[model samples]
Target: MTVARKRAILTADSVPMLPAHVRLIFNEKRDSWVVLAPEKILWPDDISVLILQNCDGARSIGEIARALSKEFSAPFSEILGDILEFLQDWSDRLLIRLAEQSGGKP
Candidate 1:
């Protein structure tokens, strides 16, 4: 993570959501959902699509990662860092936001 990214305040309770200009849409042609923004479209792979879907303003990063791990039969630690890095990258691009909340650290 960059210095600026490290400066971001992310925690277990911080809810993440698509930006106002970004929307999640199903692409029937591709049989997947995509992140649609004003100037760009993100076609994430199967796992990534699920990750993005879980970014709704309800589940925390920690909660999402935990649930995804069990659902996918993967280890929590294996996906935790990647999930955080993915969210932080989108947050940096203004495509997503980690809403402020007080709780456990991710």
Candidate 2:
């Protein structure tokens, strides 16, 4: 018998981090940042790089969105929506994981 693990859902309260098997590195040869995971390599755009860099397992989704919103002077709701979608896509690929939440409300 085989068991499958359930996928985690991303919420405003969820903290995101790169999984142990995954890494984000600057590829000197390519002159850009790349996400290295096993045999997979992904070249994310500049904006995506900013978002991924903030996935330090410390900030919740909401916090990240707020920071980016302030930095870019964009609306919070818009930034939040973009972040949620971006993180969800990466999470589904097993590149990102939700860290254990510290005591706090979303």
Candidate 3:
């Protein structure tokens, strides 16, 4: 038997909204870190929102893939691979936590 690894993902609609109590914002336009705790809102300039927000606690890889397919109008298989790659990069940076199923599946 092999061990399971957690995967990170987020939905397109929920991407603009951060979790309660958590604050995040980007400031490439001004070169700063804009944070709003207790009132999280996605900045229009924040591209990471699309890549990171799908990382909800229990959403599966397949679920995210379908959602992204509609959102980007791209092929499911391609979007799936792309999202996986994006998540891997974020995981390496410690930006988000990977979802771990009780069993051994992403």
Best by lDDT: 2
What TM-score does each of the candidates earn? 0.79, 0.91, 0.51
lDDT of 3 by residue, 8-106 (tens): 443332222233344555668977445454433434334355545555655665677788789879999888776666655544444444433223222
RMSD (Cα, Å) of model 3: 8.5
| Per-residue alpha-carbon lDDT of candidate 2 for residues 1-106, written as tens digits (9 for 90 to 100) | 9999787789988899888798999999989999999999999999999999999988999999999999999999999999999999999888888887323221
Q: lDDT tens digits, residues 1-106, model 1?
A: 6565444655555678776688889989988888889889888888877888888777888899899889989998777777888887787787777655223221
TM value for model 2: 0.91
Sort the candidates on lDDT, descending order: 2, 1, 3
Q: What lDDT does candidate 2 reach at residue 85?
A: 96
Name the lDDT of candidate 2. 0.89
CA shift at 7, candidate 2, in angstroms?
1.6
Error of 3 at 20 (Å): 11
Each model's lDDT: 0.76, 0.89, 0.53
In model 1, which runs have C-alpha deviations exceeding 4 angstroms? Answer: 1-9, 101-106
Give Cα distance to truth, residue 19, candidate 2, Å: 0.7
Clashes counted in candidate 1 amount to: 0
When sorted by TM-score, best at the front, the candidate numbers are 2, 1, 3
Stretches > 4 Å off in candidate 2: 101-106
